[model samples]
Each structure stands twice: as structure tokens, then as C-alpha cells.
Target: MRIRVDDLSGEATRSLIAHHLADMRATSPEESCHALDVDALREPAVTFWSAWDGDDLAGIAALKDLGAARGELKSMRVADAHRGRGVGRALLHHVMGAARARGLSTLWLETGTPPAFLAARRLYADEGFTECGPFGDYVNDPFSVFMMRLL
Candidate 1:
């Protein structure tokens, strides 16, 4: 698989992001859904990436520079066809390495607590992320699980 920075312009990337957003909304309450849309992911502070397998998109992920030596992981999704193929882990390690290279000391993320999100939560835990209180603009929400990892 080839992992590269994405400008959020390709049809496959846009479609995947749309699917991710829709899935998040369908799985969680509107108020508890924090997934970003295409425009939001295009923000200057965020860097998006797409993992590709030949002509197919394998997955997508993003890293947000939170300033002050901290960063946030966002929009991590492994395409259905690529699940269990290490795409998620590869994207995660790529983002983590980018954060560390940027001199960030920590990484943060917010995911849902529903059964549908079990794999994601487990992946984070396995990667050394531990539960934490809400950070940044987030507030307490029973449906949201916040996690943090030192880089």
C-alpha cells in the first residue's frame, strides 16, 4: 500500500470521507458526533492522508496540529475491503511519526463508545492510547470516549 498526503479533491477520497461522516452520524447522536466533513478536513491546521492499494483507496486518516506540542488524530477509517489488512495500523503509525517529527509530545483523539466503535477503541488501546477527559473544545459526553498517547 502507498500512503501519501491527500488534498481532499479525488472522488474516491471525497466519497470515503462522506461515508465516514455518514456512518459516524448514523452511529452516534448528532450532538455526540464530532467527525469532520470534507471542508473541515481541509482546514490549514489539519493534514489528511490517503492509503492506496494500486488503483483502490485503502483508507484515510488525518492529523491536526493542536499547537503547543500536542496533536489530535482525526478521521481514521480503513476501507471495508481493507479491514484486518493493517491499513489502519499503517495510517496510524504514519500519523504518529509525522506528529513526532513535528516535535509534538502527545496525541489525542475522540471516538464513540457504541458497539460499532469497539474495533476502533481496541485499536487505540493496543497502540498505547489511554482514556482521558475531554480536551480542546470538547465537553463531557457519555457517548464520547477521549484518548491520549504520548509521542
Candidate 2:
């Protein structure tokens, strides 16, 4: 699979991100959902990527520069057609490498704690991420699960 930086403006990319946003909304309550919309991912501080297998989009992920040697993982989603194929893992490593190259000291993320997010939580844990309190603009919340990993 090829994972590359994406501008989040292509038709296919827009469609995929829309699907991602829809899934987040469907999976969690409005107050708990933190998945970014396409417009948000296009902001200057965020660098988005899309993983593809030839002509098929396998997954999407992004990293936000939180400054102070810290980063935030955002918009991580594996497409329905590619969930069990390790696309998420590969994409995750790609983002991690980018963060390290940027000299970030740590990477943080916020994900839901419901059954729908079991796979994501497991992935983060397997990648050496540990539970933590909310960061950035986030506040304390029961439905939110925060994780962090040192780069």
C-alpha cells in the first residue's frame, strides 16, 4: 500500500473523509465525537494522509502539530473494504515516522471508549500508547479515552 500526504480536496478523498465523519457521528454521541471534518483537516496545522492500494483507497490518517514538541493524531480511519488488511497499522507507522522526523517529543490522541472503538483502542495500545488525560482543547469526559506515546 502507498501512503502519501493528501491535500484533502480530491473527490475521492472528500468522499472518504465524509464517510469517516459519518461513521464517527454514528458511533459516538455528538459531544464525544472528535473526528475532524474535511475542512478541519485542511487547516495549516494538520497534515493529512491517505493510504491506497493501486486504485483503491485503503485508509486515512492525519497528524496535527500541537507545538512544544508534541503532536496529535487525528482522523484515523480504515475504510470498510480494507479493515482487516493491516492498512491501519501501516498508515499509523507512516504518521509516527513523520512525527519523529519533525522532531516531536510525543504524540497524543483522543478516541471514544465505546465498543465501536475497541479496535482503535487496541491498535493504540499495541503501538505503545498509554492512557492519559485529555490534551489540547479537550476537557474531561467519560466517553473520551486519551492516549499518548513518546516519540
Candidate 3:
């Protein structure tokens, strides 16, 4: 699979990102969903990446600089057809590498607390991310599950 930093300008990448945001909105209340839209993910501090297999889009993920030696992982999503096929893991590993390449000493992420996110939480845990309090501009919210790892 080819994983490249994306500018969110391609039709396929944008559609997949929109799908990810829509799912996040559907799973969590508006105030609690922290998933970024394509345009938001394109901010100067953020680096978005899309994974592809030949001509097909497999997944997408992003990393946002949070100042200090910190970075935040954002918008990780594997296509429904690509779920459980190591897409999320591969995308996450790629993001972590990017974070390290940028000299980040810590990486954090915010995910939902619902049962729909159990597998996601497990994935983070398996990657050595421990549960943590809200970082950055995030507040304390029971619906939010925050995780972080030192690079």
C-alpha cells in the first residue's frame, strides 16, 4: 500500500475524509465529536496522509502539531471494506513515524468513549498509548477518551 501525505485536494481522499467526519458526528454528540473536516485537517500545523492500494483508497490519518515537543493524531479512518485488514494499524504506524521525524517527543489523541470505539481503544492500548486527561484546548468530557504516548 502507498501512504502519501495528502493535501485533501483529491476527490477520493476528500470523500473518505467526509465519511470519517460523518461517522464521528453520528457516533458522538456534536459538542463531543472532535474529528476534523478535510479543510480543517489541511491547516498549516496539520499533516494529513492517505493510504492507497493501486488505484483504491484504503484509509486516511493526520497529525497536528500542538507546539512544544507534542503532536496530536487526528482523523484516523479505514474504509469499511478495509477494516480488520491492518489498514488502521498501518496508517497509525505511518503517522507515528511522521511524528517522530518531526522531532515530537509526545503524541496524543482524543477518541469517543462509546462502545463503538472499543476496538479503537484497544488499538491505541496495543500501541502503548495510555489513557490520559484532555490536552490542548480540549476540556473534561465524559464522552471523550484521551490517550497519549511518548515518542
Tens digits of per-residue lDDT, candidate 2, 111-137, equal 998898899999999999999998999
Of 1 and 3, the candidate ranking higher by lDDT: 1
- lDDT by residue (tens digit), candidate 1, 119-147: 99999999999999999999999899999
lDDT comparing candidate 3 with the true structure: 0.92
Distance from true location, Cα of 147 in model 2, Å? 0.2
Q: 6-106, model 3: which lDDT tens digit per residue?
A: 88999999899888888888988999989998779979999999999889999999999999989999999888888898989999999999999999999
Give me the displacement of residue 94 in model 3, in angstroms: 0.7
* Model 2 TM-score relative to the real fold: 0.97
RMSD of 1: 0.6
| Model 2, position 95: C-alpha lDDT score | 95
Lowest summed lDDT across 10 adjacent residues in model 2 is found at 7-16
Q: State candidate 3's TM-score.
A: 0.97
Per-model TM values vs. the true structure: 0.99, 0.97, 0.97
